[model samples]
Target: MHRRRELVGWATVGVVLCALAIPWFLWGSSTVVFGLPLWLWWHVGWMVLASAVFWLFARRAWGLGVETADSSERASATASVGDGGGSR
Candidate 1:
């Protein structure tokens, strides 16, 4: 779970960096792809790529079923440890 969360974080950073940086790099391009300017196509491509990355992150890291199980285990462990009821 921790590794999956880390992967999701890295993927999110990648998507954000690509969205912000790629267009700036292509700011003066006059090339065309599929009838759009190259810079415009670059933005569109990143949008699609970001969507896929987010979907993968969601599927792997956001599943409620696993979280519930982990939470329940933690709750049981905490209950077994109990508060010390200090300083009587």
Candidate 2:
């Protein structure tokens, strides 16, 4: 259930990411803003938004779908690092 919920969350984010990948509403429009075409501004703003979304995901949910080592291995790795030994 938890994994399903996470997947759904990611799916929604993915939809938002893809749906705005192109500024379809600005196509064939002659609008300009601050000496730049509106579509170019849309792309610049979209990139900023995408970067923010990715930054938040990296900070909060980076391992959502990643397979990780089991507890014993994680414990050993931590112990090794704690003792100033590199995990081999």
Candidate 3:
């Protein structure tokens, strides 16, 4: 329900929708899914799916809290700048 989870959920939906609706070349064969062509699914489907699932699991494990590493890194970097807005 937070920004991070919301973004990931939207991303998962977007990728899956794209895979089910878009078509592309693959070994000169037309790969299909749900009678439609798979574009993102061809290479990133499983990975994204796994990531989505993992994130969902992680969210639950962490009591549905947003403790992503990137957010922490960003916060630390900002704090280190001390509000001077580092310009280098």
Candidate 4:
């Protein structure tokens, strides 16, 4: 259930990012931010946002389990190796 919620949260973030990337939202704007046109700023902002979202999703969804699984597998393999070449 927790994982499902996390996936849904990520999906919501993806949808928002897609919506923000649509040019219509930034069209007809003459403002400038940080020495860049508004439209360009919008895109740059979204790019940064997308990177952050991806990092969060990767860390939460895959990072922890992969490390734990790898460590346990290594431990089991070492134990088997120590058991003397098994079933010769």
Candidate 5:
């Protein structure tokens, strides 16, 4: 039941994102704010960005382990990071 609810919510979000991007991609120039041209790319970018963030959040909550990087890769990144030691 919980999974279904999360899926439905995500699906609704994805649909809304697509709706925004598709129409903007098709006819975006007319929609403007303060004389700035509202291009389709802008909408597409936002939709994509939002989806990525939401996916990460949901994956974490669902324990899906769907991060942008592999575990080993993340480990390597951490290994290469600055020291945890604080100033004396």
Candidate 6:
């Protein structure tokens, strides 16, 4: 399940990256916003989208391939530390 979710998340990131790379849709557009061309605006919006996707990835799946101790293990370790690591 973890592997599947990771694959899907990364796939979404790849799609967003590809969209940012190509601005074919705006090639014929002459629209202007604020002072910039449509394509420039497209880039800005795409960059914001990419940042959001990356933020989600960082929040949810940033620990790819890294080993982490289980919660139970952590609890036991904390208990051991609280006992000074010596027999009473």
| Candidate that scores best on TM-score | 2
Model 5 alpha-carbon drift over 4 Å, by segment: 22-36, 40-48, 54-58, 61-88
lDDT string for model 5 (11-79, tens) is 676688667665544463576655655675576578778878678766654432243234534554567
Residue-level lDDT tens digits of model 2 in 1-88: 4444776898799798889878998789879899998898888999899999999988866766564434434645656644322322
Q: Which clashing pairs does model 2 show?
A: none
Write one digit per residue (lDDT tens) for candidate 4, span 1-88: 3434555776787798888785586578888877988888778877988898788877656543344544544655766644432322
Q: Which residue runs of candidate 6 sit more than 4 Å off their true CA positions? A: 65-88
- For model 1, the stretches where C-alpha displacement exceeds 4 angstroms are 1-8, 11-22, 63-88
How high is the CA lDDT of each candidate model? 0.64, 0.73, 0.55, 0.66, 0.56, 0.67
Of the pair 5 and 6, which is ahead by TM-score? 6
lDDT for residue 49 in candidate 2, whole number 0-100: 92
Error of 2 at 40 (Å): 1.2
Q: Clash pairs of candidate 6?
A: none
What digit string (tens of lDDT, one per residue) describes model 3 on residues 1-88?
A: 2345655765676576566443344645666887655654555666666577668656644422355645544665666744332322
Pairs of colliding residues, candidate 5: none
lDDT, candidate 2, equals: 0.73
Ranking by TM-score: 2, 6, 4, 1, 5, 3
Q: Which window of ten consecutive residues has the lowest lDDT sum in model 3?
A: 79-88
lDDT of 6 at 52: 88
Q: List the candidates' TM-scores in order.
A: 0.52, 0.69, 0.25, 0.56, 0.40, 0.57
Cα error of candidate 4 at position 65, Å: 14
